[model samples]
Target: MEGILNAVVLFSNFVLIPGMAYGSQLALGALGVTLIYSILRFANFAHGDLMAFGTMFVILITWWLQSIGVGIDPLPTALLALPFGMAAAIAISLLSDRFVYRFYRRNKSPAVIFVIVSIGVMFLMNGLVRVIIGPNDQEFGDGARFLIKVREFKEATGLNEGLALKLSQGLTIAVTFVVVIALFWFLQKSRTGKAMRAYSDNEDLALLSGVNPDKVVIVAWVIAGSLATIAGTLYGLDKSFKPFTYFQLLLPIFAAAIVGGIGHPVGAVVGGYVVAFSEVTVTYAYKKFLIYLVPESWEPESLVQLLSTEYKFAVSFVILVVVLLVRPTGIFKGKVL
Candidate 1:
């Protein structure tokens, strides 16, 4: 029983907690992508870079605050800078839409054209972020690092394995829950939300019904920008911020969005956890876990990992490919890709 408890604690520390936090981040990101696709009818390849861009602002503001000795104890100062970051991201998003996407939208260009243009925008934002923040890891996390310390847990539980919960992880989960609830409420209940939904359902009919397309588009960008900033900031606080790392995050974010059902908000959130847990479970070394569960003589000599951590992203790719082949519409029956 003691060994069993230890194994569970170890698993939670290494896999469950991290997976939940990562899933929350991915869920937020995929939500942004799904929003753009659902209303704007195009895959914003620049979404990841937009996250990086917003995070860049957050980092800069955090540094400035720290320099002035301003902080909120037991919580990261980045939280205070978050609104500014969201504003910057929203401004950029609206500007891009006006200058780049609006032209295509007005001309009634094909969706493919919008996609290609997004890729171009992706490169430009990626470069701009790199130039501003440089290609290095930035650690802006401060204040309370752990909500539950490993030593304290071990002392209390008398277990060989200890569980440590990070403040960032807890914050990520909490913030995601609130954001998701608010988003769903707005989408289901608000007048603008209904208008947006109607427009998405049938643009021509909605236009005839006096639904303002411009207002819907602006609202969509604002929501997307806010999601991007929050997701990026939470992720940076949990792990570390590196421009290229966010770039690499694109694959997993897209995979989560598609796996849940592109253009489906609920699907995106569920797919995020699915992808996160799959990656963590596959890459985790389970030698100690098996040792605790199996008889001494039956214990394995080698690590029981299905794949190395370095190949974790491949898990997302595989899942994406499988989902695309088996159910292009995804788990929630989103639009066919």
Candidate 2:
């Protein structure tokens, strides 16, 4: 029984908790991508860099707040600075829509054109973020680091293995739940939400039924901007923030969005967990846990990891390719590519 408990603890520590937190972040990012695709009819390749831009704002504001000696005890000061980050992200999104995307949209340009434009936007945003924040890792999380420390858990349980829960992990899960609920509620019950859905379902019919196209577009960008900011900030808190890391993050984010069915919000959320768990489970070294469970005589010589940590991101790409090949519509019956 002690061995079993140890195995469970080990698995939970290395796989379950990390996956959940990472999943929550991916869900938020995927939701943003899905929303823009559904409403605007284009894949915004710039979305990842946009997240970095928003997170940069949060990091800056967090620094300013800390310098002024203002902080939330037990929680990271980044939480307090999130709103400012969202505001800046929203402003940039709106400006991009107005100055760059608006012309092509008005001209009824093909979706491919919009995609190419978004790639250009992605490069610009990536460069802008590098200029503002530099190309290095930034640590903005300051306060209570863990909700439950490993030593405390081991002492409390008198167990051979311990479970550690970080404050950032708890925050990520809680904030994601609240944000997702609010988003679904807004989509289901709010007037603008209905209008947006109507527009998504059929733009000509919605326009004929008195739905304002411009308003729907603006609302989509606003929601996407907010999601991007929250997801990026939460991830930076959980890990460390580096501009290039976010750019690399685009692959997983896009994979999550596509895997879940590109235009479906619910699919996006589900997809995030799938991708996160796959990545964690595949890359984790299971040698220690196996030793805890198996007899000493039967213990393996090598670590039982399927892939190295450096290739973790590649897991998402492989899954993406498989999903695209097997079921292009994804798990949710989303729009077929």
Candidate whose lDDT is highest: 1
Query: What is candidate 1's CA lDDT for residue 127?
Result: 96
- To one decimal, what is the Cα RMSD in angstroms of model 1 from the true structure? 0.7
Task: Summarize candidate 1's per-residue lDDT along 223-314 as a digit string, tens digits.
Answer: 99999999999999999999999988889999999999999999999999999999999999999999999999999989999999999999
lDDT of 2: 0.94
Which portions of model 1 miss their true places by more than 4 Å?
none
List runs of model 2 lying over 4 Å from the truth.
none
What does candidate 2's lDDT look like per residue over 47-150, in tens digits?
Answer: 99999999999999999999999999878999999999999999999999999999999999999999999999899999999998899999899999899999
Q: Estimate each model's TM-score.
A: 0.99, 0.98
* Model 1, global lDDT: 0.95
| Model 1, position 253: C-alpha lDDT score | 95
Could you give the C-alpha RMSD of every candidate to the true structure, in order shown? 0.7, 0.9
- Score each candidate by Cα lDDT: 0.95, 0.94
